[model samples]
Target: MALVEQLNRDMKQAMKNKEKDRLAVIRMVKASMQNESIKLGNKNLSEDEELTVLSKELKQRKDSLQEFKEAGRDDLVDKLETEIDIIESYMPRQLTDEELEQVVKATIREVNASSKQDMGKVMSTIMPKVKGKADGARINKLVQKHLS
Candidate 1:
């Protein structure tokens, strides 16, 4: 099923099960997707676009979790961790280190990225291929490692 359709179905299930925390996270995700759709003039988002939205939400939750940890708010940290886990269920399986390195190597070869100066070129070429499957920071580090 499409991401939006899956979200709707899961939302209903959450409501049926009276999972308040899970339901709240689902609603937040749906709202963010709708906002992105509105920003794009109300067009239905493609799967890639939906994944982008999901990834953005996950990133926000992770950042919040980090801040909460630093501030010693274990309660909020746990809540955010739950939300992050819920969001992650909808994302593509993350790439393993070996897989990521292979992709980076292939991209480096494809783009003829010889040094750090070609990091931008290599990243631009590889990101679309790995989008929603790998973290940008991780990809950047791998790219830098290969290039340098």
Candidate 2:
């Protein structure tokens, strides 16, 4: 099913289950999608666009989670963690370490990436292939390790 449809179904389920937090997250995701669509001349977002939005939302939550952890704000940390989990649920299945490593290695060769100086070349070439399948930091570390 499409992202919007899935969100709609989950929203209804959350409402019926009286899951306020989950429902709120779902509504927020849906709103973000709608806003993006509106930004693009009111056209529906493509699958890639949906993934981009979901990834952005997940990244924001994760960044906040990290900051809240440093600040010793347990309450906000818990909330951000929950939101991250919810956002992640909408993302594509992530690549395992082995799988991601393989892709990174292959792309490194594909781009003729040699030293750390070529990190940008490898990253730009690999990111589109991995997209939502892998976290960029993980890929960067893997690429660095292999290049070393």
Candidate 3:
């Protein structure tokens, strides 16, 4: 099923099961996607657009999670961890380090990137291929390591 449809089904299931936390997370994702759709002046988002919203939401939660951890807010940290887990459940399986490295290597070769100087070129070419499959920072670090 499409991501949105899946979210809808899961949302209903959460409601029926009286899973407040899970329902809240599903609603949050649905709302984010809806808002993105409106922002683009469209009624529906394409799968890629849906993935973008999911990735963006996941990234925001993760960034917030880091800050919450640094602040030693154990109370908020646990809640955010649960939220992160819920959000991640809707995302595509993350790339394994070896798989990500292989993609980076192939892209480097494809782009003829001899050094970190071609970072932008390599990154632009590779990101679409690995979108939502790998973290940008992880890819950037891997590219830098391979190049240097």
Task: Report residue 6 deviation for candidate 3 (angstroms).
Answer: 0.9
Taking all chains together, the TM-score of candidate 3 against the true structure is: 0.97
Candidate with the larger TM-score of 2 and 3: 3
Candidate 1 stretches greater than 4 Å from native = none
> Local distance difference test, per candidate?
0.92, 0.91, 0.92
User: TM-score for all predictions?
Assistant: 0.97, 0.95, 0.97
Model 2 Cα lDDT, one tens digit per residue, 1-148: 2999999999999999999999999999888888988888757899988998898889888888899999999999999888888888889999999999899999988989999999999999999999999998999899999888
Query: Per-residue alpha-carbon lDDT of model 3 for 64-132, expressed as tens digits?
Result: 999999999999999889998998888889999999999999999999999889999999999999988
Q: Which digits, one per residue and each the tens of the lDDT, describe model 1 over residues 75-136?
A: 99999999999999999999999999999999999988899999999989998999899999
Clashing pairs in 2: none
Alpha carbon deviation, residue 109, candidate 2 (Å)? 1.1
* Number of clashing residue pairs, candidate 3: 0
